[model samples]
Target: MSSRVQVVEQPGLAPAGLDPDAAYAALAARDRRFDGRIWFGVTSTGVYCRPVCPAQTPKAQNVRFFAAPAAAVSAGFRACRRCRPDSAPGSRHWDHRGDLVGRALRLIADGAIDDGGVAGLARTLHVSERHLHRSLVAEVGAGPLQLAVSRRAQTAKLLVEQTDLSLAEIAFASGFSSVRQFNDVMRREFGIAPSGLRRTPSERIPSADPALVLRLRLRPPYDADALGAFLAARTVAGLEEHVPGRRWTHRRVVPLPTRAAVTEVTVHGDHVVVRSGADVRDTAALVRRVRRWLDLDADPATVDAALGLDPALAPLVGAHPGLRVPTTVDPWETVVRAVVGQQVSVAAAGTLLARLVAAHGTEVAGESGLRAFPRPAAIAALDPAAITGMPGSRARTLVALAAAVADGSVALGSPDLDEVEAALLAIPGAGPWTTGYVRLRALADPDAFPASDLGLRHAAGALGLPEAARALGAHVSAWSPWRSYAAQHLWTSLAPAPVKEPS
Candidate 1:
């Protein structure tokens, strides 16, 4: 289905448009459905708030609805104090679309612009800087620089409220060039000095252990129990622990001035609380990457609407309303896992991966037993014969993949999905299933489906759908852009017993 709202290039209004009367109605109702996707700037108070803000609603004439927070900010409205609009979950609008704008937004959230600058971002997207800037400004209400600043402001706000770190530390940690720049942006964005936004001492993060506790927001109807079960089944020994109805802990190694941390994630109502040993400097990146790994930003309503149309998927969709395609925090690690998992059960793959980690992965500090997955460089340095418990052919394939990644031949972080797939396919013994799994988990591609997998084939057979991989692919075309979610539902339905309900 197409989007209902259209974009109009009007001055002093958002670039994206909806009927003003309807937007005001949604606000009056305090509609949580539109909370993240829409913001209303109150002319009377000169503040912008989410549609679901609890403060008294302003008169319709005094309100202007924006498709994004940036549009309201660009129009000269500061974030509302009561609502804290920046804390809302990210717009599912970006997650459901696969356009240039959507891809750019995802990359920005991942700190691509912070690491590469606008010029580097454009180069990675295979577009000229002029074209990229113009396109962004026309589609959204801001240019690349403004969007990046807005992102940094959000990060800074979270740090100020949650941590006891000095303003100077928070400044550079949030990617500001200097304390002066940070101070200026804070005033402009929040209309307060950084110190004024500090949390109460009782709420402050513990100073002794020095960890950052932050919330990862998401749309409602999240199936936490299901997600926990999936991760628990695939947990690699010494690298991760998943306790049902409790918490999941995993070690992460972040790129760009490389750092390591162990993250503990627990799902609260409509949000996930994350406790990480990553320094305040790395917390913003860690949170963003973990959100991507869990696929938290996905819009369940949009996905369900699309996939529920199919007779085969309709029941499963209804049963599992918020099923997510589990992804990896590390792209290279996911690729290696996919290769090791080929032609094996989930338990067998976990054992092999645990052995690989014991042999080559670095031991990292954490409350839980934590070990960083072997980096491409470390894996490449190893002798193929040393990677035991796999066929010699598979061992050679793993060695070849590691060397390619280490030497920059098979780039996992490429912006171009086609190029990444092509590079993966070019390597010997990296088959279609392995490549598709990597794309689905590592790249966070929502449309990727490993149609050749035995589980999927069996599921299709039981459902009386096309059983062959090629035929199944053709039949599943209607689930475009959400096939990965559909596959998860199919896999869940294949279990002999009914799947447990969320706690």
Candidate 2:
């Protein structure tokens, strides 16, 4: 069953790096490996589909390839009903690419377009609107607005299928300007009204609770237990908690743009269930944050393949196949954590952060027994002497860093990694390890490696690699572009092996 299609030069039709021949091959074979990597639109049906679409493959002449779903939509193709490409795991390409288009897409997914229009997004990226548009169109085959529209439609569709929220609430929550616009966009994108996408009662996953529960899809081989343990060890008392139960469940107060919500996340085999009490309008943003925090969009196979090449990392990769570098839901909170974590144990840092949260964190409106992490302004306004646990110099550094973020001198949301790194390094007491750790988790830099980290150095020494920071840094260069995952593997290796009971 060698399904093949003739790939012609469709100049300006496909994204820059996508090979039409390879894309068509994947599509024809219904390859699951290419699920999020590529999409195709059929001229006859005027519909786009995921690579793993179960439908019959179309003719070569009528097929067109796109790197992103937004590109297909922008080219006047509706989503395929059968495959539901909108719910596919996000492309791993975005994880490593720090290019202008990549950065723009990251911000767009985070609701930057909904919060601020195209012009504002461009300004944040330090680019002119025209330049930004041209670059995205050239590389991604769609401009910012089309991408945003596609995102909204996907969010709306997810809400329609999963939740019992009203159409009006879904519209507002998905960032549509009005209910009519939501209906119009939904119909235009999916060739169906919003209500038409809903699942029957029998098809819905059952939940006994009243909370808004949503299933987030992810690539497989996820080491949920390992990731949970990492978060559990560093859990701040009032802000986040990990329950001891049959399933690994973590509850945390997520501060969304519109409001703060308490999210209860339970990790399953292939996906994680998110239960939240936030307003419907914040669902889309909350989903994005949860995905990012859990590092769910990662293609573990790809990362494993790359890092597994090294002799030292091969055993690690074999031992823990899908370990993830746990990221932050809030960039500011991560920055605070990174600064406080410098030269201190993880437990000590968590204890100090809990105290800080108790002193300055704002209470959630409806949720009792939880508080959001203190905002930068609150920390920045503090007197240096007020921070009780840490050294006075470190206290000054935290306040300085907080003030820098509070006043917009440091843009955590910026896509430009170099600029962000420079700003962080400029803050007094923020060293390579602090900035690198922030880049690793908060900013989601895949290549971010804090070579000077004590844990990393110690792990490298134990692995028979170079023990010194400089030597270890040089040795780990072979694991470039996925050093973050490599770091996770190394850190996990440091944990004590579980004791066997007379097996």
Candidate 3:
């Protein structure tokens, strides 16, 4: 983003040149690489915008730069009436960060910071509040509260733009303490009043189909065809469907304060439209989970460039740069899906997973009539024979898997992939492939190499196991923490030809 858009705030802010000419050069070129990290504020127009903004670039002398939307607004620049910086892709740090900061961002995205205070967050992260603040500030150029306040303000802005929600409701739902607080934060972050952000509510998008409609983004070269085919084949009969046009629909039960809900996701180009069939009581949290599940937060250029160098993967990377490693919001759902797929054809596995959900899951309170995926506790307590119907080894495996997850033995979203594998391996029926799948998909581990996976091996054929393993390891090491995404792309190449989209 032109050396971070040449951060030229107050004079003597720093030694960095932050040359206006360089920043203007980047803005005029309309670079997508600067999508989120840096933003441009045109002094003449009294507006700030994303680097990829389609509007005409302002004069270089009339331009300024800010580290964040909040910073820009705090400087008296209003959001660009045209580009709407509030809705731009989130901060880069949010997508790539790990450790206390990453976890804290995830929690904040999920409304933890809103619902729970700093102490609550500290307790959940199992660290002192002081430590949490120190770590966040060190890593993200902002502390947890700054990050969260930004998030809450963004949520409030979105609710204003999209929904018929009252400002006060938006206040609470967006995690503000009061309407006054919401307004203040919005003004501080957006440089616009709450009333200023609103647009007339149009006729609602028809939800005739089973689709959860919302906007979604990924880095370039997204193989919509590849993703569509994969999702279509594996969708559950009753709960999920991937239409021919690359539109995907999957039912998920949304949890709310008053009750839970059944929501569907309709993912199309550039946006994943969510059809709640219920109030978007807390649109922020729902949006956060959708981003996670779709792996929308990944930076593909960084990942593809790293993993694409391998001779074996170079071709696959060439074809599918936008390939994403599918993830789930709930680890229990992920483990169960993995278990259901065991020894079964992909289609059969999807059907069984749906069946298991139907048999055990509670009906969601909202409109779509879908049910929640069974929780770990629910599955753990179920009769193994009733669950499997085939009463043999698979049943035993399912039971063990459920028990382990139910008791926290299998840490699905664990930072420790090895720990997850160890926990899953402890279960009788969980094989190396299943454990690896869980690690790769559920835990989001980049290095979770499933060498035993037939698909991976076949995809790696001619390279030979030792050689494949060595090459893959070396190639993916460059991919580092994002290797899971690389593995997903490789696996996609190996998946049966009549590919379907994710469930």
Candidate 4:
């Protein structure tokens, strides 16, 4: 379904197109989504990015408008280290294409192009390579490979700007196939040697070779305290820690494929710092996973507006206009968290999670002292006694959950969420509420609603299930692809945060 509103080039702000003068006027608003989508290149400095670039906002005459980073690079502007305009999520224009094109963009970001060639990606998308080629060229001025190449170049830029990784490592990390290819593309894209892209040398960085660490950005009024409080409540024992002040703030390593090492994540303002313990050959791929896990790519203005139909949620909609549901950095951790939360209060589930991590998780040694979340095999290998305090029934369910995950009976990453929900039900003791929660939080499916959740149920009673489903579904269906965010608003709106009672 295409957006009723076409994304006309911001001829300024209105379709008539505003000059640099008017565009800068919008910048003073600190609109983060507009940061990269529009830019002004200073002729003097030869730099251009989103208006929100925190360095120094340039004067009107020095700026220029560009909808695409490739366009900016075409005109000669290196990406800023502080404001990585290249890393912005695909324009929401892609999202509104309720067709093969939209799904293709979503899947491409999920690493389809890097994993396989155009034919393979096209096949997964149920379209011909030729048709896929035409659609991308028609819409974005880049074919699938061109789009993927652009993404790769941006990834290279990030690694060059942030880390000490070699060009060869940076190439593969950025999803390029070879060192020469990486260097060639970087020069083509940025018109400079890859080596010249470095910003500054970090005095102290992680020992992980062939790894690149970068921060993922989001819009402001993010309700970080709410996000932290939410994580602090559900963070499992050894797998994650939100109560901080020790080593890496909120650190826990999740498993990676090549080496059985941990991946740590810490949240800064509007971004999460991912710390890799082992060298990652594909830095772009790693960053994509981190972005998906943190759910950072969501465009909030679109989401907030989509979720604002219901009057009951208007206050939450007002307080934090661009709220996002928390996301899981590791699918494995998501499964474990779901199993722990089954019949327990959020606090109880969190206690069990911490205990589980401490017992089976590996230690990440640093003053940022973190530990890797335990692996599926580790849980499968453990004694029932390790969950000593948990109910025997719950313990059995968890073991069954582990075995399912370990055996590939349930593949976790981006599972057809509905299928996963059905599979969860097939497991003994799992219910609709638990499965729904998993979809809403773990899978990041916007449409997944815990219709049976006490809060949702109460919120819906005024309408009844059929009426509620109709009313709620009708209300949030416009949120379409982002219904999970709408559900988060509905839930958070009723927040019963440990009360001193609102004065």
Candidate 5:
């Protein structure tokens, strides 16, 4: 193998621009910013670790840096026991790119591989299995299966450390098919059996109930207040709930592959506590969706540094250092929400969506009082004339979108943003704003900006920039690649000031 790192010249997967020397420097300094962006394997000990791993740093000559954790494992290295590199927040480098590698990574993280296997994943990406395997190996130093294996190991380790799920439960929950396979993979990845990886009693969270409680890590300075407020303001009555305060709690019905489960998230300091009763088969998928929903994988320091360069946005960036564009767990829900929200105020949109959910959504079991957002098939069955409280045109648009989604003509799971956008635009009533908003929240496209939005236009005009969509788009071009964060900053400026309570 060459001493130099090999990358496939992709846009966002350049290891965050770190060469071997720079990667070593970051590793030696235990830099938190580079924690997820790069991993270095120790040639001597044959273990890989995050840059922020607290163990003794290996000699520079003994280190080989990789852009992904799967690469290290593929290169014959176990995870560092002390550092638990598998627990590192996901790299934001891959979050925004619409490329093949980026999309593949996203799907793999979402348990596409576990659900359907490598052949299935290739089919979804519309590539030959051979081509997909080769591309992934060249770009990220691992094939799709290897990447999925690494992900499963990570999930299993997390369950071992955090939840009190039985070993068999953890195995299946992490996407392993058999206990033997799970044990072998765990030993190979971590140099220990699954049981050996469990945390001490004092360190573990007490699992007194059936709910799987896990603490998801966030790259700080996370603005929990800002994220909570954004979700709370637009919460649908039967589908979501938010209890607002200094430390807020948000709950929503998440539709998993096997079934729909209600998931609860509470903000605790640097991390959020996630409580879910999802099936063991769906636990890994639920965790990945929760991470996306919370925007926990973002590199706040890098985003803030980039946006802070603009004088107009500098103040907003400074005020809300880690303000995230809160995304959705279900892309269909986002599409429906975006379409229904058109030409209507946020409050009105929520009321209308609530009506739809109550009428068509699947109610959760027991008395949680939550209902999963109506799936496309459910909504597609309704006649446009039956959708109350919305204009006929908008109602027709919603049904049309539902039919498209139900038919797989508009694949929300597709990695190709342009293709998805084109298909969405083909719907009769879906316009630029609807497509743009879907791209931003549903697809988690960081550069996605609904420039036509009145709120965004007003926010830009207040900042002394152009108010027209075309002009504002031009002005905000400098915020490229990070425009989603820039948009959040702008919209946040228009929010009413919070009342101060007596100290």
Candidate 6:
């Protein structure tokens, strides 16, 4: 451990039992494990850096810890250029909490405020704007608006460093209201003018390049092969393509509401590369969705610690240390797939889904060889018999789901998991298994588990564990907040090895 990074252990970091000593120790050791969980701001230098920063650490008395990047900025610190603290994986603490604060953070990351402002976000979460602001301040040391501002600053910084977009364009694209606001925020948060921060032309890639590529950082022990295999098995023919160990491609409406693009996601060693043909304006939103799809924000160390205590799961955890639950880029798309998957094998269900997309999906205009999944309105307008191969009951359920979403009766990406599940169950054919699967994949719920699924039961039996859904459900309750991940491990035990295929 570096002496400059070392600090005496102390217990007074937060009321939530976050130990300052532990945070400092991780910083001293230059441990990447704590990169997102704790950020150290140096009082003397007025800059904050990630725990894994290679630069010499500041003295203990000069160090202050913050739970989030926004909190550190609130205390008058700029981001360290050397370490790029803003790019760390999101804190696992927020991902595991099912409370209002947690959900609010997730929504904020998804650009809810950028799309609708604080009032709209409040409406979606079924809470008052004032209460939401108060809760965020008390829990995370910053209010909703400030959190949104911090997010924009991070996005702007990335653009400045990685792309050759003009300041005006980058400002508007990153959700800033004006070029002046963008410049002011950059100077305030990073202690550098926006133009001064930009790399020389040759050092950065032009935004007009055919593919907009960006690197997504994630925690170690990630089983990329497992995730690739899981998605490849469920991919729809035209809407998605997967070449195991190389890339996964999909076509979707980016930035929510409007822009359309084709995205190719590839997993490298510790980072995933997202290359898209979307407009430069939607890069920030595209990055956010891709991160969710890969579950890159999940904290693997925390997950391993909790699941490793169980004897049955210990070996599996050891085998696949950083296994993550694969999620969808679009909530409606996930719901449609779940409905199609009812009472079918993975391959058969994929075929039916591909047929549905081919019939109703809006084809992309370029050489992307992709089609956007039908919007809720498009699906809601259809007769049940219009979907060729789907069973009458399943088709009706899909239309009902589309109607609910279109009518604002079921908010897909809202922070309220209970409300989403209840709305899903009210549909005619959606049962516990379907609701659980949707929750896990669409809403990104960490604890969602379809314990009654036949595949899960088979995996449990093969592992010499409880074979009954009810019994297995009881046994896995101990894996609360991580049952979704446990289900992945169990399911992977039965899945065949991934093989490369043409894209």
What's the lDDT for all of these models? 0.79, 0.85, 0.66, 0.63, 0.85, 0.80
Candidate 6: residue 466 lDDT (0-100): 94
TM-score of 6: 0.91
Q: Which runs of model 2 end up more than 4 angstroms from their true locations?
A: 1-9, 12-18, 205-210, 497-503
lDDT of 2: 0.85
Candidate 3 whole-model C-alpha lDDT, 0 to 1: 0.66
lDDT of 6 by residue, 249-362 (tens): 433434344577888777767888677777777777887888888889888987888988988888888988899888878989999989998998888888988887888888
Which lDDT tens digits does candidate 5 get at residues 1-503?
A: 22233333223333668666676788889888787888888877778888888889889877777778888877877887777687778866876787888989988888888779999999988999999999888778889999999989988888898877789988977778899999999887887889998888788666667887888888788988788779889999999898777777888899998888888898777788988878767768888889888899888988899999998889999898888888989999999999888988889999999998898899886578999999899999899998888899999999999999999999998878899999999999999999999999999888888899999999888878899999989988899898999989998999975443222
Per-residue lDDT for 254 in model 6? 40
**Highest TM-score scorer:** 5
Using all chains and alpha carbons, the TM-scores for the candidates as numbered come to 0.89, 0.93, 0.81, 0.72, 0.94, 0.91
Ranking by TM-score: 5, 2, 6, 1, 3, 4
C-alpha RMSD (angstroms) for model 3: 5.2
Single out the weakest 10-residue window by summed lDDT for candidate 3.
Answer: 1-10
Candidate 3 residue-wise lDDT, 121-144, digit = tens: 898788999999887654444567
> For model 2, how does the per-residue alpha-carbon lDDT over 1-503 read when each residue is reduced to its tens digit?
11232333356534435567766777888866677777888877788898788888898778988878888877777888798787878865776687888889989988888888999999988999999999988777789999999998888888889877788988987888889999888887888888889998777667786767899988889987688678778899989888754466899999987788888898788888898887777878888989989998887877898998988889999998888888989999999999888888999999999999888998986645889999999999999998999999999999999999999999998888888999999998999999889999899888888999999999988889998989888988889888999999999999864332221
Clash statistics: count for each candidate? 0, 1, 27, 23, 0, 0
Comparing 2 and 4 by TM-score, which wins?
Answer: 2
Better of 5 and 6 by lDDT: 5
Task: Candidate 4: list runs displaced more than 4 Å.
Answer: 1-84, 89-99, 126-128, 138-141, 202-213, 243-248, 260-274, 358-371, 377-404, 407-409, 414-431, 458-481, 493-503
- The candidates, ranked best first by lDDT, are 5, 2, 6, 1, 3, 4
The alpha-carbon deviation from the true structure for residue 246 of candidate 3, after best TM-score superposition, in angstroms, is 4.9
TM-score of 2: 0.93
